[model samples]
Target chain A: MSQFLDFIPKIPVADSVEDAMDLLTDTFAGFFDVIKKSGKFSMEFVTDFLVMIPPVLFILIIAAIAFFATKRKFGLAIFSIVGLLFIYNQGLWEELMNTITLVLFSSVIAVIIGIPLGILMSKSKVAETIIQPLLDFMQTMPGFVYLIPAVAFFGIGVVPGVFASIIFALPPVVRFTNLGIRQVPKELVEAADSYGSTGWQKLYKVELPIARPTIMAGVNQTVLLSLSMVVIASMIGAPGLGRNVLSALQQAKVGNGFVAGISLVILAIIVDRLTQSFNKKRQ
Target chain B: MEKIKIENVSKIFGRHINQALKLVEQNKSKTEILKQTGATIGVYNANFTVNEGEIFVIMGLSGSGKSTLVRLLNRLIEPTSGNIYIDGENISKMNKKQLINVRREKMSMVFQNFGLFPHRTVLANTEFGLEIRGISKEERRLKAEKALNNAGLLPYKDQLPGQLSGGMQQRVGLARALANDPDILLMDEAFSALDPLIRKDMQDELLDLQQKVRKTIIFITHDLNEALRIGDRIALMKDGEIIQIGTGEEILTNPANDYVRTFLEDVDRSKVLTVENAMIRPISLNIDIDGPKVALQRMREEEVSVLLAVNKLREFKGYITADDALEASKKGENSVINYVRTDMPIVPPEMYIQDVLGIISDSKTPLAVVQEEKLVGVLIRGVVIEALSSSDENEGVTENVSIS
Candidate 1:
């Protein structure tokens, strides 16, 4: 029975799937190139500013935002400054700033793209059905699998890293935004309609404001996911502590990997707390 | 002028509205239409006119289309095949822009659930309709504040809807509708969400506001008492069609059909029927000419144990029992006034039967139905009993029929 099962013909899906995908890719060749060029420009512009800004000013800016956000300003500021200093003192300041640039750009682009898509999904069931499964696949696919296509499209640079990070991080924002709007009470919608509000007026004044907290949560998740993709992103020549961690793994250097990993953890904590407080303030 | 007029409006919920409407035109049953076209009949063949400043109630139990009928007036639920004229404009043919304009300027609704925006403060919520219309912020604030004050919610203006009790929240809903200063108010079970006590308070509040604003109102309710208490005219719905439309008194005294009478089976007749409704013209001898002999003769002729006495002005004097009149006649009393018993029950014409039930029960002689200090009618115990009992029997028959 086992030999008979083995003798059964396979679908040969993988071999043909690649051919079909390549044809599909050829069809959208212009669209992909446009995205690649735009991604390159944004990546350079973002990296230039991050690299140009004096490390002290950068630290101060992040620390100042942290100070205002948290009531424990002294503690948050000290933690932030010390963590940043640890990276700077380790001679990884430029690398750290590059990672910051990558994360900032990736998160911003993801949010920009995800929100309207999310809103579109909320507004129409057909869009939601078509987009939702694509999102699920994007989220569930191995992170390493994305690097192959990302590098193929934008070709092994900060742009490809950011493009990959955007794809990886976008789903949460879209999902939550759709959920937030859908969860809004139907009676409130009726009330808005009853008062003679136009569709746009209802969306902006009634639905969006009520859905703010949930959307903010989505944004937070997108940002965190963007940050988490940094290490995997470094394999494609993306800079930062992630690159150091990658190098440490390659050369078996424990101290370099430990410091880089610790710095990433610190950065994650700072971003998480800061976004949370910001979201709380909005509500 | 009629503020709102509906001309055979109907709403059938489905994609095959045209087919469903054709079936409806053929006088097909809702179930048959549903079976044929998968169209759930929401409202069917309704026609009514609400006069200016009238409270026109649409009443039915759940799924009976009261909500749909009210929504149809404001074009919230557009009619499938009929014309709704709001001050002479056919709203069914109106474009979306024109409909919005109509809703903004002419009609505003109060929902059963309050539908107050939870994130907005009471003042902001009240300002919502005006905000939608792009009214100047200062003007809207003034109008919204004025409405809040009228609803007695000014003190809670800055609080969010979630912070208020259900009654208070519904008042915010009321204030929101009122702030628009629209010509018509569509209240879809506006007070039904409240506790009974609060519902009564809100009903009274609405009545008071109606008096003040005098806007045409279309109110929806399942509660008959509420309909009777507030509706200038009520349209009772059954199976998505308006079965009867009449004033409260008309519906009570002369129900349009056995269905309406059955529907009114639980209504307390004593609460609804007035002394004027049940009272009969009194046969009273004028004290100016009627001696005891005459009073006695009048009592015998009327086939009664007692006779009512009145003066030349028709002012109610009292009542003289047949035995007392006879005794006075034997003694040859000059007037029936000496034998007159002043202890009988006397009620005003407008007093509800329930209010006089105690007095009627205590009196041996017929109660005097007086209006402006004049003897208008007499309410005998037997007559009041008959009026109450016959209606009760009718209700009893309806109850058993419905149950079976």
Candidate 2:
């Protein structure tokens, strides 16, 4: 059995795949450049705007948002105020802003692309069969694999970081949207159709409204996943609190890493609570 | 006018449609076709015509294809073979645009489970059909409000469907369909979700609404009692085939097959059989032309102690007993009108037997069935009992005795 196993030769498919990727990169070089420039410009603009805000004012704005989003609940609002003040006191405020910008961009992009694709998947069997496996591959694969292609296309920076983060965070929104729309009762769909609704009318009037809560849940998941991608993205020179954590890890600085990690957790909790409140309000 | 005509329409659900349809043509059994070709026949060669402003009911137990047959009328479930015509236009042959236009302008449907959008308020739900038709916002809103008002649901207009009771939500469903003002209304077990009392109220309300709008309606239900109550004509289905189509009384008297007879076995006959079915030709005297002696002679000839008295125009006057006639004759009364008693219960010919049961049970004399102020027939107690009992031996006897 060992001799038989040894008799099998290794295939040269890896080299062929690398060669094919290179050809694709070369052919779409101009297209990729345009996307890279635009992506970098937008990311920098958002980061600069967030950083320029007076820290106290930014904290107050977030607290107020949490206050209203949670229907005047004091807990999340108080948490937002205290948490941001602690991050500011620890001198990690700028880094927090950078991570916020990165997460914001990645999540928005993922939703823009994912929802329509999800609708397509829900509507057509052929699209579903084709896209389902791709989504599974995207979600189940280790997060690091996306960085190689991201770096290849956009080079090492915040743009490539966002591109990788989007790939990491996109599946939940797509899957949830498809699920939510499909879960609409058959009777409701028939009722809509019986009323002479055109295809688009039926989807907009009946399906999307009923599926709103489930879709919002997916969106919440996507935002959190995007936030989680920040640390991995920092490896590709994306600036954020993730960089601090990354460097602290390299030097084994336990205190620094702990502080950065805690900052991320606070941010994650605030975002989760805010999204959940919005979802509830919609329902 | 014929609003809809369904011709040889069949719906077979499966991959081997051609083989299944061939088996269907060969008159093979539904289960045999399913076994041989892996196809389930939904509706098999259904044929019917619905007149404008009529409630045409299609009824059967679950999985009997009655629902499938109703869906075929609007082409919601496309027929595998044959044609459906609406006002002489072939619905099955129409392209997508024409079909959509027809659905939008010509027909609307109400569903079994209420099918109200949980996210939408009652007003919004009611407005859905009109909105889909591209009506202007103001016009649709007004129309929806009017429909809601008609259904007595206007007070709950701003409430979501989840907040309303099942009957209220179903009222919203009906209002939604009515808001569109379509030519035909397709209702698939629309009241099946309601409680019995609410179901009865809704049925009565629907009949009341029918009197005002007069839309051609194709209603689907499994409840035979409901079909009998509202159906102008009923089509009974079994195993995807329409077994019979007739008025409720005709089907009750002359069932098409054993399946129909069995299907109807549990029906409450008092609810469906009208007084006309139980009424007999009464032995009556014209009080204006006949004297008390003549009335007594006619009572003697008919071998009855009492006689119904009418005027020269055959207008029902009252009943006269032999004693009253004899006393009147001895007292030298010219006509039996003086002796006639006006205490007997009088009913209209169209009144259901159930409605007259109390009146008949309390009255000493046979009830008079009057139509247009004329004594058309008399509903005797024995005839009513025989009709209510639905005895096979006396079925023809009571039915044949009815005045056409």
Candidate 3:
């Protein structure tokens, strides 16, 4: 194990840190340019189109979907309507969207990498042995500790913030994916074999499908972790409702701070409900 | 012809140097071998051949290498040293691609658990085998649908596996196997996971399917009764070695050792046996409704205590007795339970006289059904022993036979 540990990539400290931060801003600017100019990645355009519909109508549709999927119609309706009202009252609807976009982007990337790593770990004993300790460290390390190297490389703004969130949020996905795949019943594997499934076919058709519930659970945890990281990421110039809340608290503005906090809670609720609804549909 | 054969299979783990050192240092006895190297022989030089279309059973308790034997046939686990031939192909040396090809083309297995994918619809789970074989999606779907229909799960085709009952899940597993159209079926205690009634139904279903398909099968189970019911040839295993291999009748009559005998002891031989055991010539002209009367008179003339009855069509009715007939005649009553079916394997005429004595000792009227090929007759326990003992002309001989 010690022999294996020596092989991991070491973080370098140099002027390259400043260079990376500049590169992150440039890359983000290029992405925004592509979306704004070409209409290829315009989340703003998508949101504005959505916003054209009456807010009440959109909320009702979302609430109904949530209610059907969760079997909690009353709760979903109350949460959805109240949360929307709070976000508008706090004057943070746009900031809430920006924070949500960060969480969504980071979590999606985390899932893409983490799930495959998990599946690989479950399949190979060596992969499991290698990845498990790293995953453990990632899970246990302080949220503050995640920011240091993140800041060193990408430095101040949404890019480093996304990176830090990924560091914090990624472990649950990988851990649960591996756990889910590993815990798929041994009899199921044999059944797949008996069904004349090739190695790849069995993994896709039998193993992954059977492991869906647990993998979705991993996804749910990743989403929640990403949400938690948003407030922390706010300390480093990643603008969102978290920044307003922090500022209000510093200025001793109790009403403003409470409203900002309530808006954050609403954003969290919307994301949790939406992702959980998608998960329930799949199951 | 043999469809599957395993020869001199010895699966040993650990390096040779340790074994060599232990061989030199310790006494070369069984206990010493077990203690010295901590070497456990999972399958010790085991060998067997399964013929085409034969229902071959490996029956053993846990840790007896039965499951290991099935896995070895499919190369699920590599053997330490051996040769395995499937339809004369040397499977032990097949590479991964070749092995997968063999598994996909020639054989399929059923697990103790149904092993349906919870996330997939029954149709998709069934189609999984075809997907692995690289069949087109449309073709696989059609094939899977047909297989599901055959297994009586077509109605549940769109439902996830969790939506089905245990028995239905097992049917889906069966449909999945059938979808591949493999030549051989390997079942590793497939019915053991089901409720008793469901297990019996599944076993009957398997037998019915086997009748239609005639696929060579290797079934594993710990239950001797199930082994007798399903197996064309059974291999009773102990400690990773086969203790006996024979047909049900052969094993029942001539168990190879005490261990095999222990499994046979509680077996209801009457149920296990067929009409082959109880055929004998009738002794009278009264072959219809008065057959029981002739049987009773014959019992009296022979000085026998009991008589078996049969109807004119030669279907076995029950047994009757002269004492009961006389008592019935006086009382004017007719009851069928008084008669013992001649088709059943009662204690044989040639069995130990002690068993004959025991049978007679308990019943007010004891009957032994006499069989010769398919013909059925009746024999009384007392008359059989009286003949055997009187002909020997030695009273000591009877006691010696009983003691032995």
Q: Order the candidates by DockQ, highest first — what do you get?
A: 2, 3, 1
Name the regions of candidate 3 deviating beyond 4 angstroms. A1-58, B13-34, B145-156, B159-165, B266-404
Tell me each candidate's TM-score.
0.77, 0.84, 0.75
Compose the digit string of candidate 1's lDDT tens values, residues A1-283. Answer: 9899989899889879678768766887788788878877876787788879898998998899888888646888888999888888878887777888888989999999999999999999999999999999999998788887777666777778988899999999999999999989988988898899998999999999999899999999999999999999999998787999999999999998998898888888888888888998767
Tens-digit lDDT string for candidate 3 (B1-404): 88999987755445553583345344254345557666765666678999999899999999898888888888776776679999999999898788889998999887777777777799988887788788999999999999999998899899988888888888998888888888888888878888866876787788898889898999999877678668889998887778899876577667798988777666543333322222234443223556445555677787755555555555445555566666755655444344443433454433434344455566554443444432244444445445444422333222222221
Q: Distance (Å) between predicted and true CA of B330, model 3? A: 16
Our model 3 lands, by Cα RMSD against the true structure, at: 8.3
- Report lDDT per candidate: 0.86, 0.90, 0.72
Shift in Å, residue B109, candidate 1: 0.8
Residue A217 of model 3, lDDT score: 89
Query: Which prediction has more favorable lDDT, 1 or 3?
Result: 1
Candidate 1 segments whose C-alpha is farther than 4 A from its true place:
A1-64, A70-92, B268-404
Question: In order of the candidates, what TM-score does chain B achieve?
Answer: 0.70, 0.71, 0.66
i-RMSD of all predictions: 0.8, 0.8, 1.7
Q: Give the TM-score of candidate 3.
A: 0.75
Query: What CA RMSD would you report for each candidate?
Result: 8.9, 6.9, 8.3
Please tell me which predicted candidate would have the highest DockQ against the true structure.
2
| Cα lDDT for residue B137, candidate 2 | 98
